[model samples]
Target: VPQDEQDIAGQWRTFVENNRLDAVVCIAAALRRGVLDEAEASRYQRPAVNLHQPWELSGLGQLHEAAQNADRLVCFGGD
Candidate 1:
């Protein structure tokens, strides 16, 4: 859905500026799904700890939460 890196970056920026989320957690397998900040590009051995968006998310908390709630879904197929 995001057309470019900046689109998500902008969303991340807006989210950080507006939400109450506490931390960012990237799924090891899916971390490559964009959201790359400056540090990740520079760090040769680490997952760019420095350039991470100041106070934003890093992964799809929605999908993961949905999967966790899969067994307890309602008739509409949603938790």
Candidate 2:
């Protein structure tokens, strides 16, 4: 994430945690943008990872699962 988006991401993470929400980040997209969780970072030999708890880096299957379980699903797209 860029410096400007860090705060927003933190806020979203907090909101998800507080609301007991599930957040599944598309692993391919995140990796393409240099966003990785601890496991991914280690696997890719990255010194650090920008993603943390409450935000899961996963595949589309997880998204499908979330949609199946959720009352409503909202998706955001980016360049």
Which candidate gets the maximum lDDT versus the true structure?
Answer: 2
- Quality of model 2 by C-alpha lDDT: 0.86
lDDT of 1 at 38: 54
lDDT of 2 by residue, 1-79 (tens): 6765568767887899899987878899999999999999999999998988888888988778878998997666756
Q: Clashes in model 2: which pairs?
A: none
What's model 1's lDDT at 75? 32
Clash totals for all candidate models:
0, 0
RMSD value for candidate 2: 3.7
- The TM-score of candidate 2 is 0.73
Q: In model 1, what lDDT does residue 20 have?
A: 54
Q: What is candidate 2's CA lDDT for residue 39?
A: 95
Q: Write the per-residue lDDT of candidate 1 for residues 1-79, one digit (tens) a residue.
A: 5554467756776787688544454544333664445544454354555335454334567556866977774333335
- Model 1 residue 29 CA deviation in Å: 2.6
Model 1 — which ten-residue stretch has the worst lDDT? 22-31
